[model samples]
Target: MGQVRDQRGDHIRDQSDDQSPDESTRKETSMQDSILQEGINEVIGTTHLNAAPMGIILRGGRHTLALFKRSHTAANIVGDGWFVANLIHDPVIYVESAFGDLPDDAFTTEIIDGTPMHRLAAAEAWVAFRAEVIGESSEAYSILLTPIKEEVLVRSIRPVNRGFNAIIEAAVHATRYIMNHDPELEWLIRHHLALARKCGGEREKEAAGMVERFIGEDSL
Candidate 1:
């Protein structure tokens, strides 16, 4: 087996020769797909288990997150050098975590590669990784997460719902709008809210309401 250094100059094994036929086929299929996948994810870091909804970018073989400067996620990852990215399908989780901390019941502790880490109890999948800050700007820290352990906790088939997707989109914009109070972001939030109301189920409608409440209805 060969070895390569990551952005942090840490030696990482090249697993190309160790893969079985199934794993090799999966790798080929993944490479054929779009290299970038963006989604809202729950990130848990710090010993206190600080949780937040953040945008996760999966490009090539690395998972990356752009942590806003001064945010708890940035501070925790910098201090501890590790965190977990959780795949959460619930819009309520996104809206609540985006605004503030989630309740204690929302989290559960599990050992990943012999290290205890906090993860979302409702996560469909979770990846525990070491954070290597590859770059930084005045606004945010660019981090490359090297996965040490990953697991899919649940697998279920569900049809796509536009309303649910709209809620996710609104929550993403709302997270930024609350910080800058940008009028354009506010419009996007309301636009998604409308779609959620028109097409979503009760849960989507409730989640949209939470977003509106957090962003303040007076401005709308």
Candidate 2:
């Protein structure tokens, strides 16, 4: 993986508003075309994507648990031209949003300027979902979305600190959703759980409990 270049810099990419009329139209057309996938190569999607922060932690709100809640926002230029889905979540949360079916087609693996971003296509979107069991019945909702223009990496990662237990509680929480849905990520998920186990014993029981509740033996 390539280094972040320099950690002291505040690298932000907010292209939604800066594009020229023609350039923006072209990009939009390209993204829409890519999504159709008549013959885009799978390997083209892997470019510069090997080194990206896999998951992120989110701070949720009260409506997060309540109905009409909105924590995460998915904004997009739809076939009709615009779409928005305001979604909510837990107080301290983990979210696996920017990914979708046909992974390669979902994001553009381009490093525009210095930031790596995927020009999410029509079928590709940003969404946030959460559910809770209400006795015998469980209610769930999803927030369909568009990619964000900017975000900060909480901490730059390196081989030295990217160990199993190195994941924060929020990382575990966010990852649970992805790990559960994608069987291919089983090994990566187990590695995080094993790290949680290592941080076990009474001292780390709270953390361990998090693992159990989310991805432990019974949960898995």
lDDT agreement with native, every candidate: 0.65, 0.27
Q: What TM-score against the true fold does each predicted structure earn? A: 0.76, 0.26
Off-target runs (Cα >4 Å) in candidate 1 are 1-48, 217-220
> Residue 87: error of model 1 in Å?
1.2
127-191 per-residue lDDT for model 1 (tens digits): 77766566676666777666666777788786899998898788778766765788998899999
Record all residue pairs in model 2 with backbone atoms less than 3 Å apart, i.e. clashing: 71-87, 74-145, 94-174, 126-145
Which parts of model 2 have CA positions greater than 4 angstroms off?
A: 1-14, 17-165, 169-180, 199-205, 216-220
List model 2 lDDT by residue over 38-101, tens digit each: 2211111111121112211122211111111111111111111222112212111111221212
Model 2: residue 106 alpha-carbon error in angstroms: 36
Question: In model 2, what is the error at residue 81, expressed in angstroms?
Answer: 23
Most TM-score-accurate candidate = 1
